[model samples]
Target: MNEQEKVKFFEEFNNGLHRLGRITLIAASLLLIAVPFMIGILNDVSPSGTGFLSGFAKVGIIYIPVAIVEFLVYAPMLGVGGSYLSFLTGNVTNMKIPCAMNARDIAETEVGTPENEIISTISVATSAIVTTLVIVVGVILLVPLQPVLQNEALLPAFNNVVPALFGALGLKYFAKSPKIACIPLLLMALLCIFVPAAINQTSLLLLPSGGLALAIGYVLFTKDKL
Candidate 1:
């Protein structure tokens, strides 16, 4: 009812929402990973489904119609209402949707303006151009011989390369930051290496990576003008 009460209430409410958001993100991430495997499984089982679709042309022929239908209907509605849903949910706009939503409305409604939109758009565009160039160059270079190695199946899997590459980069960035404390960061990095080694995949490394970063940060900051 009063100023302090409102502040406290809102702080608690925000904290609760943060916890819920974390849960939602965890679920969503798992679903995203699991869905690909599920689709793969379905393709394996159902001969009439995706498995039956031969070559790139066959896949494209089937995919285009369904995609066109989705784009014409469901996607437009989602694009329009997505901002409103973000506002209603009071979660940050992880991706942008051009909307009538204002700043105050968004602030009280959503957390932050969408950074993901810009970052993802730029990243995808750059990757597409670079990859296309690389593939063309590779095709030219490898045209003479070794046709078998040029096949998709023979090419190394780069899907899981992103995590290791980014992890190394992230550690480098944090290590260079003004973190005087080494214990936490060291421990976490070690854990990141070991946890995935010991247990299953999917964010087991985060426990260590996060802990180390926190420890480094704390040791560097809390020690003060010694």
Candidate 2:
């Protein structure tokens, strides 16, 4: 086929993907909401409307901004299908993002390219499937593995899982461009060290860290230092 025909085919595929993604997301959300209400009805227990609103407001006030920021930050790298799948599967930061990044790196695909988009989508979908299977297995094994999981010797490892994951993932990028990463890394480190509370506010802290990185990158770019 000609280049034009290929382009048209890809566009059509993307359109269909987006449509399917939207419909699935909506259906999943409705099912999530309906399940709880259905259970409540079956149990003949009514939840307090006032308490529900109050609880939702409390959670929303914190999560709404974070969700918006995450969408903006992750969407471009994830592409349309990956973004939709990641958001729907709900582990963008810890699982999907890492999976997608690793896939791109392994595939030697650049972000924003068609190859990267397809790789990212496949990576995220695989991650979701693997995660679900792991969860199911974990649940089935929970009672049997209680002693192993609850072992004091493994506590430290469990606690450090996130840090270890990110550290390993980040080391390569930091090595590649220490100039762009060092300042933000140092600044955040200092903030976390001094404030301590900043560690708990990592989601909120991404804004300043990201902006600082962007500004530094821009300056370096203009100066031809990158």
- Candidate No. with top TM-score: 2
Give the Cα RMSD of candidate 1: 16.1
Candidate 1 vs. true structure, TM-score: 0.29
**TM-score on alpha carbons, each prediction:** 0.29, 0.64
> How accurate locally, in lDDT, is each candidate?
0.49, 0.89
Q: Please give the lDDT score at residue 223 for candidate 2.
A: 100
**TM-score, cand. 2 vs. native:** 0.64
Range of the 10 consecutive residues with the lowest summed lDDT in candidate 2: 54-63
Tens-digit per-residue lDDT, 39-129, candidate 2: 9999999789998987676667667978999999999878999999999899899889988999999999986666788899899999999
Give stretches of model 2 more than 4 Å off: 143-226
Residue-level lDDT tens digits of model 1 in 2-62: 7788667756755664676567757767887688678869888523444444344444554
